[model samples]
Target: MTAALAVRNLGRDHGGGQAPALDGLNLDVPAGSCLALVGPSGSGKTTALRLVAGLEVPDRGDVLLDGRSVVALPPERRGVSMVFQRPLLFPHLDVLDNVAFSARVAGASRRAARAAAAPFLDLVQMGGYTTRRPGQLSGGQEQRVALARALAARPRVLLLDEAFTGLDVALREDMHELLHQLRAVLEPTVVLVTHDHAEAAALADSVAVLSGGRLLQHGDAGRIYTRPASVTVSRLLGGRNEVPGVVVGGEHRSALGRLRLPTDVAVPDGPAVLLVRQEAVVVTGPDAPGADAAGTVLAVRAAGARRALTVEVVSPGGAAVQVHAETSPGQVFTRGERVGLRLPSSAVSAVPPEDAGTEEPEIADRRTADAGRMPRTHRVASPAVPDAGVRPDAPGAPRRRNHHGDHGT
Candidate 1:
């Protein structure tokens, strides 16, 4: 079961703070699709989730499901359910009873609820564990049962608050697969709160970015990742290189050289910030064909199957820029080795230096697939998840005015 969700002017104040924990948040989740709320800690991702779940009251705003306001409804009557980070299963109850708890609350007999919950338990692959107590199940098993419990209730909208955060990498991947399966078959409307960019990219049809209790940007998952609305949003999505530049016509030029702006994006003439995703940059031997810049390796660190490097690039005019990049784990570069860089035009985005709050969130909601409109499942990819960095609030850094000798590496 699924229903569209609308959040209008949602505001919550924890008090004693400079800003409300959640302020004027607006989002729309298409029936049977998923939206992810992403940001740093205290960005109101969880606060928004709680408000929508009716677990907490909003200081202002209205929550509408399928166009009907549910503000007066208690949590139990809201036709929604939440799955928390921890399984928090009842230690004494067996798996089957745990999943049937909601039905039991609704006045169903134990035998009737258990029988009704059998299929949901099977859906999560825990049917055989019905007699096992929560304490006897593994962490992953407990979560699976928890998910079953939430599903057995037939919620019109499901809220997941870091439900997979505590799981190990392998277990998280397993849960992601299960969720994909559930969405494909059940098509429940969902709002997920998580700090994990990769998780959001993998699961959400759309992404809503928030910071300082204000909505920063929201849009299609791909748009949010490839073309962030501001430098803050780009950094949140893990875009590393912020090349200060000027846009003349549609082209952007920085000290490093030129970056072809996306044709679909109309960048105003004058100062702009060219966003180069860290993964979009490919390092090669100095003087390699199509090399955009030359740089000398400053540092390198290998972690598991990925290698990270800090490189300092020098221009012909003696300007220097530090860039961060990643390469295959097996590829090795010495600290002093010189390298060439290639930044694909398609991977670059341009945003005005202003970096203000988001435009109407309708742009995000407008892109959502209409109710009963089946969307593709399991779509997931992004430019590398680079290290987070501070926002470059101001733009138009120094640039080279004149060219001299050969371009320096």
Candidate 2:
């Protein structure tokens, strides 16, 4: 299958003695599929999208669209449409006209443009708002119309730059589902740039993690989330357990405990870090002992549908390794209380020390020293476990909802 969009060894420099915003980054978006680009601010994610859209040319390498090198093409000729964080609509144009602007600009008659834009508006369920002007429409409505506008352009690839950032949770989720459905029916290759992992995990066919102007990792969302390539990728996905340790005497001595590495790295015996996901840390007690367990609960907070319990586990050297566990309704613990925590064989991952920054240990990691030795092992409650980050504190959690209507991710 031909790639709908491709970037190879792409780099760009802004020319003021700063590093290139985009360093030798490469990625391919299969036709009729969606890839989510996620990273911290200033990670060059938007720059990459602009490069693919032909809004900006790379300083090196190339961008190919539909198997053709379109680096020299203008934005209009690149066969792509971008929906930015804020919907850019013509103030004087009504919804129908805004949605039809692309076609109109391409020499289609006003009547023809409206006719062409109708079905696209209907796709986003904004058909009835066609008569309203941009200023008269709500933020979500304006975005829906923007989607229609982008679709009417008949682009082979669609770029969304945090398009739903200003909407409420319910509206944002609705847009996410709408985008997926549109992709399935329209069959356009879509690339969504977002900082929210939950959004990426929910909407993307594949996710690319970008940092420091480089593509850190790209793969199926589930696999990437479960097994991130490095500590950065793990943390970017909202992982709470990043324990830096060293491989000594064939054992990985982490604050949690000294355990043999499940796999070997090319790096010979030295300091390393373990990237563990909070979901992988199972909370246990005397009644429910766990493997390589050692920790005392530091704090626990009810997080919407699940509870977050922070624990500090001790390493062999008495250093602290803080880890968080998502507990279910029946499972609960309190601060300063000893609890068994389990790191399933599949949960622990070891990466080089450089990727794991030496920041102040989280509250849970500090309590690991007070934790006891003599680890306990617990049996799996359900051999077959079927289950289910961010975005506001939700209704139950303490959070401040801003007037701009943006929620935490």
Stretches of model 2 off by over 4 angstroms after superposition: 1-3, 247-251, 258-270, 289-291, 315-319, 355-409
Q: Give candidate 2's whole-model lDDT.
A: 0.72
How do the residues 22-105 of candidate 2 rate in per-residue lDDT, one tens digit apiece? Answer: 999999888888899987666678788777776667899898887789888777777787776666566677888877777666
List all candidate RMSDs to the true structure: 15.4, 11.2
- Candidate 1 residue 5 Cα shift, in angstroms, is 0.9
Candidate topping lDDT:
1
| TM-score, candidate number 2 | 0.81
TM-score of each: 0.84, 0.81
